[model samples]
Target chain A: MRSVLPVLTIVAFILGFWTLAVVPMNIHLAADQAARGDMVVEPDDARARQEVGAFALALGNPAVIPMTYTLDRPRLPGPQQVVVELWNTVFAVAPTSNRSLIYHGWVTLSATLLGFGMGTALGIALAVGIVFSRTMDLSVMPWAIASQTIPILALAPMIIVVMGALGIQGLLPKAIISAYLSFFPVVVGMVKGLRSPDAMQLDLLRTYSAGPAQGFWKLRLPASVPYLFASLKIGISASLVGAIVGELPTGARAGFGARMLVGDQYGQPLVTWAALFAAAITAAALVGLFAALERVTLKRMGMAA
Target chain B: MVSVDGNPQGLEHSAKTARSAVISASSVDLTFQTNDGPVHALKDVSLDIEKGDFVSFIGPSGCGKTTFLRCIAGLETPTGGALSVNGMTPDEARRARAYGYVFQAAGLYPWRTIGGNVKLPLEIMGYSKAEQEARVRRVLELVDLAGFARKYPWQLSGGMQQRASIARALAFDADILLMDEPFGALDEIVRDHLNEQLLQLWARTEKTIGFVTHSIPEAVYLSTKIVVMSPRPGRIADVIESTLPRERPLDIRDSPEFIAIAHRVRDGLRAGHADD
Candidate 1:
């Protein structure tokens, strides 16, 4: 409480100052649009231009949106309007209506869940393969890293096009993208964690006449829990990235990414920002859930969280 | 699993019903293939360990003390030698799980509780679950770690971890116990305390022990017979019989007899490693 107090106050102060600066400008712009008899002003139409224009014109920058423009051309949505719109979408429409926030969120959430699961499984299997084989370490590890070097931005469109040609339309490309992104960290982390049991620990197991499988199940796998969870956190976040990427290919008509795209087309910056925040919040919650699960499970197994 | 105290296993390299040496190493030589060259770790050494003797090996670094222990435990096979435990080869003896090895660093599995670590050998050796639990409890008591059975290794102090390791060794009741500097990392106070406890424990169990250490006082204090070793060809220099009594306490160090033995061990160590 004490640590966050001053920070909260500073944040509140910045927010207050920002509202003061922008709300009046929004009102002036709305007033000017009203004066011009125009009904709707695209949020992006004059955004960059207005800033430069205000600087250039210098006088009666009273062209400030809130105080001067017509009602439709309110230079920007005030923070309160954005919040109200966001709140309505989240609390009101999301929980109700057939075409709702939950409905759209489910589309992205399904992709994320499927992707995360596939990625984690594949990652663990690959890690096991890499750790157990010298040839795999020399070969597969480098290739896994190389696969990620190409930006997801480039990969997503190519995946969609290729996948569409193959008559594999839905879910597969998104999952593959997420798995592609998520598996690298899991493989790297699990390999390091699995191999963390040094020569002495291996020798100890050998002294027991433990077989290779026995040694792994009894020692190495348990030792790798912390690393696994750490990788899972990374993997889950990457799953969100893949879900959004899946949206970029054909400008998806649903999901948060789709919402943002629609908002951009309609010059609704407030809606776009709202969707981006939702996606971020969803990702944080997913990661947090995994963290809680890790703590409970690994702690029971006597591993450090 | 019954105690063989009445007819204690003795040392004899001959054909007889369980009458031969419990452990025999004749003309043993070990060479590790290193990047530099073949490290001549042990050279043409021979020794026999009786079933109920406190034997300690004192040597400099790279003097094959650990290698010898490993060989006996079947962790390392001798390059050239006829090594046997109860007339069987080291590999066969290991298949039978004939020895309990305690490494220098305790080597307790960090994920296991102290009691669970002690139970590991018994579990591997196919003890009944109840018997394993009983034996784990009994050994934890022997090492004075009865209350710490539930605690993980990292929770314990270094001395306590070592004692827990000793409990692990003792838990399975193996015929032989091989210790490689088991108390080497502890300070004087904990080492002395553990030494006394170990002597008492030795008196009680009478298990044949092959201990490896570099410290002169540690050599003189716990050993009944000390094998001094030299490096750079790694062979036994001398095997001196310690004249101390079986019941040694912490106060035994102040005694003139203990000091004389300490001096002799010091000289033996110097004579042993001086060539290196």
Candidate 2:
């Protein structure tokens, strides 16, 4: 935390201005209007106070200040309103109610973790194969790069439909989508790491009468640690992208993606922004967990910085 | 006939050199394939290292000093001729771990602590945990680095690192020690001190040592026999037996006996150069 404090500060500052100041100001301006007997900017002429939702906004008359405040398009929800709704939806809603962010978050997190695990396993297998074989390097490597070029947003829906046709539904299709998007970095990073042994080190290993297994386990694996961690960082972020992409095609009514769809239909911009922020936070947390695991493993190997 | 006595005098010139030789490479050849034709690095070389003897190979750069050492270490198989170490192939010797080799550099694994690096061979040979720790401790003390066992390689000085490497080589309890210019990278002062220490260590253990160096003084100071080699089809020009005593002091390098052997090594190397 001490070393990363500067980066955290810069990120926090940027998000602070963008979320609180820039987003809200634009929303207010866009929402402001004198139409339908409403004041463009609410007039506080030492006068009538109407509690326009959680806040006292001064206006000439009760009916005069019409629907102008509610006219916000691409709106940023007021902080207090979001807070109340979040509390109501998250804590207040039970199995009896449908507005459960916890359930939705769990759904999304499950898919992300499943896909991340599958992707990491497949990525490691492919990387080892490619590293050990010239044929795999010639064939699989290019395909991995090409796999990402096919625009995941476009591919996600097709994958969901195809898996549905194949009688595979529920979590598997989403996990597959997530895995597909998340594995390229693992392969690339691992390949580079596996090849990182210096000539002198290799020669020393040769002198030891060590077989390929011994050589790889002793030298290449140790050398590849930093690269593998680097790949994992990239992989976890891509996993979030996969889960979101999966949601679009599946019309997942229970997760954050489903909420985005509903918000877009109802023209509730704050709900969508809130969902986006939640996903970003989840992804950041996942990567942070990986960072912690990396430190522990590398420290044990005596290769930690 | 070779004499049975191990006297300092009449050892080289008398009836014969010791025939109870452990390593005897005769008409040995090594050719490496280049973009052009094959380049012969070693050819028609013949030499013998007696049991429990210290021999050094010395010459100028590209003299195949290192190549010869590598051949003996079984890291590189010779292209031609018969070469036997302890009456077995170098490959066989290596698999048996008959020799402990120290490279020109320390080559200690940076990721490991000094003790851990020393235990690498013990681990490879699969010693018991208790045995590994005991041997590592003993070797660390042998090299006078018991205090720094827990420290990383980078934390040690060059001289200390070199000593750690020596400890690593000695850890496995191999019969022969093959060192490739192990002290070549050290300063003159450090090299001199290590040479004396190595002589003492060798005398104490009675281990057969094969060392390669380009320094004539270093060769004369440490070796019981010096194999003078030349490049461009590297072969031995002379095998001068050193008359210097086994109990070498650092200042013994300044003695008349050491000076005379140094001159003999210089002459052998110059003769090889003239052939080129």
Q: Pick out the ten consecutive residues of candidate 2 chain B with the lowest summed lDDT.
A: B1-10
Clashes of 1: 26
Please give each candidate's TM-score.
Answer: 0.86, 0.83
Worst 10 residues of 2 chain A by lDDT: A46-55
The digit string of per-residue lDDT tens for model 2 on A1-305 reads 58699998997787666444433333333323333234444444222222242123322333332232343453455444455556766778883355676677778788888998999899988988888899999999999999989998888999999999999987889889989988889999999999888766676665566677777777788788889999999998898878877887777876778777777878877667566666777788989899999998877666778
Count clashing residue pairs per candidate. Answer: 26, 0
Best by TM-score: 1
lDDT of 2 at A8: 89
lDDT of 1 by residue, B149-177 (tens): 89988789999999998888788757788
Query: Which parts of model 1 are misplaced by more than 4 Å?
Result: A1-81, A94-99, A165-167, A298-305, B1-20
The DockQ of predicted model 2 stands at 0.35
**TM-score, A chain, model 1:** 0.82
Best by DockQ: 1
